[model samples]
Target: MAKNSEKAVKKTTNKIVKSADNSGTKCLEDKNYKIENPLDEEYVNEVHVSDFMKALAYDPVKGVDTSNAEHISAWTDALPVRGTTSSTKNQKKPSKRKLREQEAAKPKGISHSLLQYPLIFMIGLIMFIELIAYISLRQIVRIWENVFSWRGKKRTLRNNLRASKTYKEWCESADALDNYMHKDEWKKTIPFAYYDYRLLQKVVKHLKMYRQGDTMEDATKLMDVLYVCLKQNFAGIENAKLYSNTYLGTKALIEEYVEEVTRSIEALASNKYISIEEKRLAFKLYSKNYGRTAFCLSGGAGFGYYHLGVIRALLDRGLLPSIITGTSAGSLMGAIVCSRTDEELDLILNPELSSRIRICQDNWPTKLYRLVTQGSLFDAEQWCREAMWFCKGSLTFKEAYERTGRIFNVSVIPYDPHSPPKLLNYITAPDCVVWSAVLASAAIPGILNPVVLMQKKRNSEHLIPYNYGHKFKDGSLSTDIPTLALNTQFNVNYTIVSQVNPHVHVFFYANQGSPGRPVTHLEGRGWRGGFLASTIEQMLKLDLAKWLKVLRSLKLLPTVNDQDWSSVWLQKFDGNVTILPKSDLSDWLHTIADPDADRLKKLMGSGQIRTWPKISMISNRMRIESCIEKVRRLLRTSPKSNRVGRFNSYSDAEIEKLSQHLEQHDTTNNYANNSDAGSGDELVFLSRRRVSMPDGSFQHLQDKDSIKEQNRRRKFMAQFLDSPKEGNNSTQSSVLFDSHSDDSDSHSPPPSSPEDYTHN
Candidate 1:
């Protein structure tokens, strides 16, 4: 009986284990597991197993999985596991309200379908735009070309001509040019004639170089065609020259054309393709040179008035600079003196004159506010008006030079930082206006605005000016003194440099070899507006100081402690006469637009008094040198006669006699006063002195012994120059043309004066 009972119990345990395994719960998976907890409602006591088995077997509910009910209490308040089959079947159904709450609580993100359509639409739109653009590409390009039609046409024509490597190809360029210029739109512009003139220049260049390496026969063949073109274009050339000075566009075009023509003519002459007479005629008509003395003035704001006194002293001594070059305030002063007589200069220099005209109108406090807001301190119209009035109306560079018989040069820096300073003279920029140039040069970067260069319209009695987009400003930034420009560009024999830049040490002969010391005490004094003025002043001083250091390092300027001071160094070594104020003055007080009349007078007086002795010495030397120069020039030009003995060189006595004649002539009527109007006649009269002989050559020699002594002293100084000291930047080759250097008249005389015309 015991064995049977044990068998039944084992059967019951096996059934329960099978039921738990089918329910698929991990905790009840062990067959030998027994519940030990009496507190857990899901736990069964071992003594109640028989009763529990009876209750499970005889349950009222059919098909109910009792195994799922085993852990009912634990799952009563919790969510059923999702993957279990028994839990899914027996899980309680949640209320509709609870299910809806759970569905609403889920997070909803942006839909991929919602974004897809718009992305596709954007892609399709972009593709459509690309397609339309591709179809209309040529039309769009044509519209753009029309907007810049003239420039495009010019570039095309130039390219067509430049692409031609041979004479045959160039003929086609001529045809192309004719077609291009004949268009009605181009013809009405009137400036198109200038373009045609340029094309003709290209043709001439081509003709000159055509087959030159092999033979001149081919080049000569083109002369008939060339003459025909010249005749056809002669009217155009005349029109171009007449209107060339009218506008900056035409001026720039003509300048380039002239350069091209010059190169072509030079090439033809060098290759013997043209005769000497033809070349001479071409140059006389087109290119001219005036080798004369040049005065180069440095920029100084109010200190520029000091130049007036220097001019007065020079004129008093009968010395006149034939060429004037200046920058900034110097340009203003130079323009004032250009076409005016001594009396006119005196009137302009008078302190009683309106300060607005003499000095620029400067309301610094107001200008500073404008400077920060509008990128400009003040309108330059008043300055322009003053310049125009001083210069006697706006005149072309050529007009100023022709009217005054003095070459006027104004320097200006372009808007481009890399470009070198431009020197606008009669030769370089003949059509540029005098007043405009002065205005452009005087435009200080931070204090005043830059100016757009303008051009005069032809036959416009109203004087309407047109701008060609060229902008310029203060020249002092690049070339402060402009002395080197005088030497290189105009080939002036003598240069007088008047410097007023306060930062640069002048080392006057009166300084007695004392070391230069900075005036640090004047640091913040005399600031005109505020921090702006002081800052700009300090910056200018610092920049100038740095430049001085550079010059010293390069040995261009000597050290203060050097045994042999560079007093008159430029004059001795570089053939430049440098003048400076002996006493350094306050910068802002002098540089400002409206300075104290007393200070201005004092400055002018100082200039006149201190430079008098130097001017007296220089004038004497110049008179002698001028006599020699005129004699040499006359000898080369005057007809050789048996009656006239050829002089290889003049003796001291002959030079003395010539100098005495000049001095006497100067005394009879101040040459400075009369030379401006009739310079040609005066030169001719001076040249005639070659035939006249002094009554007492011996007496003249005795009188000129002092001059001979001066020459000896110059030679002694020249000896020192030959042996450059250590740390000196000078080299023998670097030395410029000296006073004693031989000068030949290679250039033809001016054509303006009939008296100057001579047969070569």
Candidate 2:
């Protein structure tokens, strides 16, 4: 019985072990293992055999009997439950109330179909429609505004042009336009507006030609149609101002007018008589729009005054100054003001006296009776008569006479039935004649003789007053004479007038030198003065047989052989050398050669070159000179020696000097020192130099010059007898000699040089 019992206990122990192992494995695999107290009533129903075995295995009380079947079963029944309770709870079915509650918790009426569509497409479509509408509206507004503005501008321009009396003067303008337009070469030389002017002229000519063959009414209709078409295609007077000063437009108009007037004047002067009516009409047109013409010529404002003065002078002298009436008045005024005499001016104005001149009311058939009245005696008969009626009581004419006499320099006399003194009308001054002649000569293509016209006007005093007035039926005076005469002299001579010459004037200022400096002042004067002087000199040498060669030598012009003339002006020098070119020399000479040479000398004498840092200047000059010399030398050497290596292999003295110069000039130090025997030795030396030596150990050589001298001596010695003999000296012999020398050199002290010691 004892053996069987022991065996049973062993068998139970084996079974418990197996069950525990299985339960532990299962727990690990299932990942839901849980421990429960064996005494807990809640865990009793779910207890398993595997749970009991696991509890027995975990609690190892040595005497506990695990072999009894009933005890084991009881223990199993009391084993802690893990998954049994969970499984039983999980197996319970949902109640009807719980199902209803879960159903109520879910969201209702949510749809995702439309949400799946791309938002980008919807947004893009909406934006595209909005953009299309916006653009359409913008375009409509632009078109409306453009049309309205264009019409308004056109109307305003037409009114201004109609008011201008200069329209008649432009009758011959088409001819001038034709001349410019017909030439194909002119299309290349002239601008688009110039060509357009030619086209317009052609169209007008064609219409006129057609009119000559048609009835007046038919011609008029055709002209109207043509004019309308032309106006539509080409900008009218309204747009003239906008394009007048721009590029070719205004210039072409002025040029055409000038050409036409010049041609007409030439024809008239050549005895090709233009009708008096035509002359009168032209003058009226020109005079009415004189202001605009003057504005065009003078650029504007102050210039216009100058130009008008010139035009007035020209008109007084019987010259066709109308051609340049608008464009060049200001320039002409400047010329007159700058150079005309008072007497000359008076002659051109042709101020004159008049007698028996009558005044008529603008709209009355009845004339007001008045006697020769008081006022300035110099007043014209017309003025005298007007003043007589206007005066209240016995008005003194002395003041009026005096003012008129002072202004016009002519005396007025009463109208006489018998023995009428020769009546003077217009006032012509000498300056006015000169101004007119200049303007006419510049504007018209002819030889103008103002002297003859003045003489004729002076001689014709009896037939008509100097002002060319005759009594009319209404007793009012009327001037039938052309105020200005057109000279018959036609010449092709033209002169250019401009304030600035681009070629000779350096417009850029950045490169100009400092004030008071020679180079700076030379640059400041611009290239004009130098170019002028050189040009004059070249002109003088025109007779030379080798003019081209001479010019090349002078460097006055570029060479046909492709040689760069600019090189002559370029300064050639190294960092140490300063070589001022001949051009600069010429400029300097010219500067000092001014008529006020003494003043220039004084100015130069007031300062000295040494006023600044002398050493720096000297060093810089030296560096430049040295560099120049080195370059020249290098050039002189073989081309093969032009390599950087060849140049770098300079002597120590040269390199040292270069380094000193570079340092003085504030250049970077990049040169290698000859004393650096090798890179390793140099590095070692550098390291040694960086570290501080122990105090009082040894005195370092402080004098660099002395050290250099010592090094020179050592180099000299090593270069002499210390060198190895030619090959064939045995290695043993060499070693023996070295050993001997080492023993001797170690024992012997260094030989003393003359510079080693110095006496106080």
> Using Cα atoms with residue i matched to residue i, what is each candidate's TM-score against the true structure?
0.40, 0.16
Best by TM-score: 1
CA shift of 639, model 1, Å: 8.9
- Writing each residue's lDDT as its tens digit, candidate 2 over 1-760 gives 2232334333432332232222111221232333232111121111222222222222111213343312111112234222110111121344586467554643344242232233334544554564454345434543643454235544344334223222121112312322333321221232332124443343334443443443433332332222122111122212222121211112233233222333322222111122222222222212111111110122121112222222332232222111121112222333322232333333221111001112222222111111112111121222222322222111112221121211111111112111121212112222121222222211211111011001112332111111111110100011001011100010101111111111111111111111111111131233222444324323332222133233333434422212223222121101110111111123333321221323222221111111111111222222222332232222222132112233435652464444442331111011112112223332222121221135513233455644564454334323211112221121110110112321111111111221221210
lDDT of 1 by residue, 1-760 (tens): 2232334333432332232211111111233433332111122122222222222222121223333322111111133221111211232444586567554643344663355456545544654554354335424433543454326665577466545432223334533543454321222232342234334444544544552443444433332222222221121332322221211012223233333333333243333443333222322222122234677777777777777667655654457666788878788778877856555554445333334344445667877876776456765554555566656666777677666556788888765444566788776676666777887888776656666444444664222121223457777765665555654555444466676655332312111111111111122122222334334433433343333333323334222211112211222222235567654546455466655545555555555544433442244235433433433332333233312232334453464444543433332232223223333433222222121135412111233554464344334323212112221121111111121222211222232222233321
Q: With candidate 2 superimposed using the best TM-score fit, by how many Å does residue 446's alpha carbon deviate from the native? A: 46
- RMSD (CA, Å), each prediction: 48.0, 60.1
- Model 2 residue runs over 4 Å out of place are 1-184, 187-202, 221-292, 295-760
lDDT value, residue 388 of candidate 2: 26
Give the clashing pairs for model 1.
Answer: 302-591
**Backbone collisions counted per model:** 1, 61
